[model samples]
Target: MKKPSLTILGCHSSIPTDKFYPTAQILEMKGDSFLIDCGEGTQVQLRKAKIKFNKIAHIFISHLHGDHFFGLIGLLSTFHLLGREKSVNIYAPKGLKEIIDTHFKWSYTRLKYCIDHIELSSKKLEKIMENEKIEVYTIPLKHRIYTNGFLFKEKPSNRKLNMKEIKKIPDIKIVDYKNLKLGKDFMTKKGKIIPNYQLTFDPPKILSYAFCSDTSYHSPIIEHIKSVDLLYHESTFLKEEKNRAINTGHSTANEAACIAKKAKVKKLLLGHFSNRFPNIKAFEKEAKEIFFNVEASEPLKTYYLDY
Candidate 1:
């Protein structure tokens, strides 16, 4: 089965610490790479991870917060300086275009590549991008401002042919093998019928990943992200800090686990930790009480999502 992977760039909330930075990640699936939340020092972390700079064609910004998108201008400028000619697409909130335009205008910078900005609307969950390999949709999140999470779903693969079954029937032409894989029965030249089920097997199940960034204890999002292979939810505080998390429009580890359990996701990854908490294991402990497959995200590590 084909699986997707996520690389953590920065998982710290609000500010950068000596050990952690802000929120940033890379979601790679089926030969396509996406950049999620370009926070401060994201480029440095990307370089540290040895990710090819030009492979990222799309960027998704969760919200307008400084910790979520502060490094965008610097990254864009670096791409320009590197002489990138391929156009880059950015899916973000409405205010980002104006902010980027003003910065480029005053700085007298002209990009060598085209910047395609797709503004996200606050109305509802909708499809943002789709290609042959995968489809992307926006998950409306409850936050201080207009925020959105993203869901990446892989397309179903084609059925595989049983070469041994074909080899037994010398009369079966090469063209008949293609038809058998497409679930079509083959008729021999002598008027004999061969069932497709005997020649091909079912395709592998589809894999999906959901990113739930910077939201409160939102139960409504459960329906949208149900049955995902991997779910990345922000756990900014411990269970004891529930009141503080609520007041700040964030979620505690317990709340994140509740959503993960309710959604029935295969794996849950917790990140966006608060700086006050020195012991990250406390968050994982509290969350494990509700969801067993929980893990605290670490910088420069890759987590695989599979069936």
Candidate 2:
């Protein structure tokens, strides 16, 4: 099985600089790619990352902040120009559909592919999307506007066949392999029963990831993100700028680390850095003081969630 991975397309806070872009990421799991945020220069970053456009069928927008979703219209337009036939699903806060519709209406351009906009407004945790392989939920966040983070969790996998043990049983047939994988006991034609444990091994460990976008030091999120395998939390400021962080409805590195520690996540990836900091390493250093397993997010860097 392929391990889940996250590719940071951009991690800068508000503006796009020559070296740093805004917030955008791609979470690839189970052969599906989910786009998280569409900040300015997202399309360019995607191209640089060599990710095929068609692979991204779902987009999760945290909020309506310009730095978080300014490039959405351009990306949709590009999909039209590329003649993409696959439908795209966008989960975002209200008003995003209106924004995209207005842009298309004025430009007199219609997309060749379908775009489904699912607006979110719940203040509590809610399941927004689910499939056989994964389940997606919203993490209500405390930001300047109505914003939400996202949680992606891999579902429990089917049991693996123990070929060596199964080969020992003469009565086992190819048709019985499906039942064994589903944790069902095998029954021989002679009425002898075989335990499931003897024929199969436990499934792979389930993995989960949480994306906490721009938000303040909100403890309520701890329960929603507890024990996740990987967490991408926004750390837009350093300790020195704690006052600025609170005023702007953003989090400092220390605050982000506190949440990670409280949630007891396996790893914490910090991003949404402010442009005032020249060296992003300081964010990681500060966060490590509170949470040992912490790293600063880098643009185009891919972090794999594997044990």
lDDT tens digits by residue: candidate 2, 201-301:
99988899999989999999999999999999999999999999999999999999999999999999999999999799999999999999999999999
The sequence of per-residue lDDT tens digits that candidate 1 reaches over residues 252-278 is: 999999999999999999999998987
Q: After superposing candidate 1, which stretches have Cα over 4 Å from the reference?
A: none
For candidate 2, the 10 contiguous residues with the lowest summed lDDT are 1-10
Clashing pairs in 1: none
Query: TM-score for model 2?
Result: 0.98
Candidate lDDT values, in order = 0.91, 0.95
| TM-scores for every candidate against the unseen true structure | 0.96, 0.98
